[model samples]
Target: MKIAIIGTRGIPNYYGGFEQFAEFFSVYLVEKGHEVYVYNSHNHAYQEKTFHGVRIIHQNDPEHKLGTFGQFIYDFNCIRDSRKRNFDIILQLGYTSNSIWFFLLPKKPISITNMDGLEWKRSKYSAPVRQFLKFAERLAAISSDYLVADSLGIQKSLKKRYGKDSTYIAYGAHPFDNPDISVLDKYELQPENYNMIMARFEPENNLDMVLEGVVKSGDETPILVIGKHETKYGAYLKGKFGQYKHIRFTGGIYNLAELDSLRYYSTLYFHGHSVGGTNPSLLEAMSSQALICAHNNDFNRGILGDNAYYFSNPAEVATLLLTTKKSDNLQLVKNNFEAIKRDFNWEKINGEYLQLFEDCMARHQSGK
Candidate 1:
């Protein structure tokens, strides 16, 4: 089977979740005797023509200069190039920008879209932008040949809103076994002596709420704010929290090993994402044996169950940071790690995607 994955900045996961999925799954497909192609931005760091036996297609990406509008152009270029490739499956990772160009997608390939989170619900976007996102969601749901929801919450919402049937496929993570305490040397950190949250500096992620909790707690224990802090929101957060010596804003660290090690060693990992399906970072935290304190919502609750503490606001976060004991939550950490191994391992996730592609191909051949 010849498959092409679109809708991410590029592979090797320089960005985030969907790119990570593309990096792992595309390589797996190649290893399994299938030809896989991943579309990368023309400016992506890794400018190679191939990666780990998978073909790499570099498309013109003007996002650096045009901002958000450049993403639309990049997706358009990818789809236009894909038209001539005759791929058996074109797996789109997200639809915020690509859905508008669905008409240009080749008719021969089966179009399968992974409906990500409800982007329209994010507080970061303006009202008009949110409305546009909602329209994009609807377009992607109806335009694609098949839809995939990364979480049951997303799947249910899709059914209720669009009356669309979608496959419920969650993300995956590898259990972190190599815990090098030495990785903390550069950050001047010790094991179990700090707390952290790794997420984009967006309003919906509740970063400000969680940081406020850190301040209110007044524990003075170091709390690392992972993610790029160069955006306007990032600058605002830095200005707001810069006085606190413990609130360290470490810019984006792409090394998975370092990130997993940080998660493994942190006393309490805060997950404040209020929108999104099974978040890849959250799963990585779970797999890395981090004792989590998540934002109380259906999405987080559905995944963590009773395994971690839940906080709805700054007050709850403060209370948890002040009172929660790492020793008592050992079992919860164990449970989350076990969950990753059992259900969210990369091998299992890769196989499921392959099966889905094969099934879609068979149905297409039979005119179903």
Candidate 2:
């Protein structure tokens, strides 16, 4: 099967979740004797024409110069390019900037959109932008040939909102094993002596609330706040929490090995993403055997399933940090690791995507 993966910055995963998904899933598709192409932004670090066996299509992207509006132009370029590719299927990873171009998508290919989290509900966007996102969500739902939800909560939400049935396929992660202890030396950290979070600096991530909880915990243990601290929100968070001696704002670390080692050695891994479905970092932390304290929500709960700690607010976050012990939740960590291997493992997820693609192709061919 010939497939085109759209809606990500591009492969080798220099960015966030969907890029990671494209990097892993597209390689797997190529390995299985299928032709796969991933759309990359012109400015993406990986400038090669292909990654592994998968083809890379670099489209003109001006997001840096134009800001968020640049993404719309990038998506338009990609959609316009896809019209001539004659792909069997185009798997769109998200709809925020791309859904508006649904009318421009080629008619020959079956379009399968991975309906990502509730973007309209994010706190960062203004009322008008949120309303626009909601409308884009509807356009994506109605325009695609099929829909995919990354979590059961998202699937249910899609059904409730648009009466659309979507395939429930959560994100995937590789189980971390044989973590290198020496990696901790670079960060001047010892085993189980610190806590951490690895997520983009966004309001919906609840970073400030989690940090406030950490401050309230009064443990004085150094908590490494990973992710880039150069953004507007990041600077605000730094100004808010920099006075706390234990709160260290380490900029983004993209190395998976370093991140895995960090999580494996941490005392507590706080996942404060309240607005997304099945966050990739949460899965990574679980796979690394980190004792998780996730934001209380259906998405996190559906994935963790009593295998980790839950917190709804700053107070809950403080309580968990103050009282939870790594020794006590060893079994919970083990259970989450097992869950990663059994359910969220990459091979299993890659196969599921393949099956979904095949099924969609069959249904489309049959005119069903």
Please tell me which predicted candidate would have the highest TM-score against the true structure: 2
lDDT for residue 112 in candidate 2, whole number 0-100: 96
Cα lDDT of model 2 by residue, 1-368, tens digit:
99999999999887889999999999999999999999999999999998899999999999999999999999999999999999999999999999999999999999999999999999888999999999999999999989999999999999999999999999999999879999989989889999998788998898988998988878788899999889999989999999987899999898898899999999999998988788998999999999999888888999998888888888998998789988888999999999999999999999999999999889888989
RMSD in Å for all candidates? 1.3, 1.2
Cα deviation of 250, candidate 1, in Å: 1.9
Model 1, residue 86: distance off in Å is 1.5
Inter-residue clash pairs, candidate 1: none
Q: What lDDT would each prediction earn against the true structure?
A: 0.94, 0.93
Error of 2 at 277 (Å): 1.0
The residue-by-residue lDDT of candidate 1 on 1-368, one tens digit each, is 98999999898878778999999999999999999999999999999999999999999999999999999999999999999999989999999999999899999899999999999999889999999999999999999999999998999999999999999889999999788899999899989999999998898899999999998888899999999889999999999999999999999988889999999999999999989899999999999999999999999998999999999999999999999977788999999999999999999998988888888989989989
Question: What are the runs in model 1 whose C-alpha is more than 4 Å off?
Answer: none
Model 2 regions lying over 4 Å from their true place: none
Candidate 1, TM-score vs. the true structure?
Answer: 0.97
Q: Please name the candidate that would achieve the greatest lDDT relative to the true structure.
A: 1
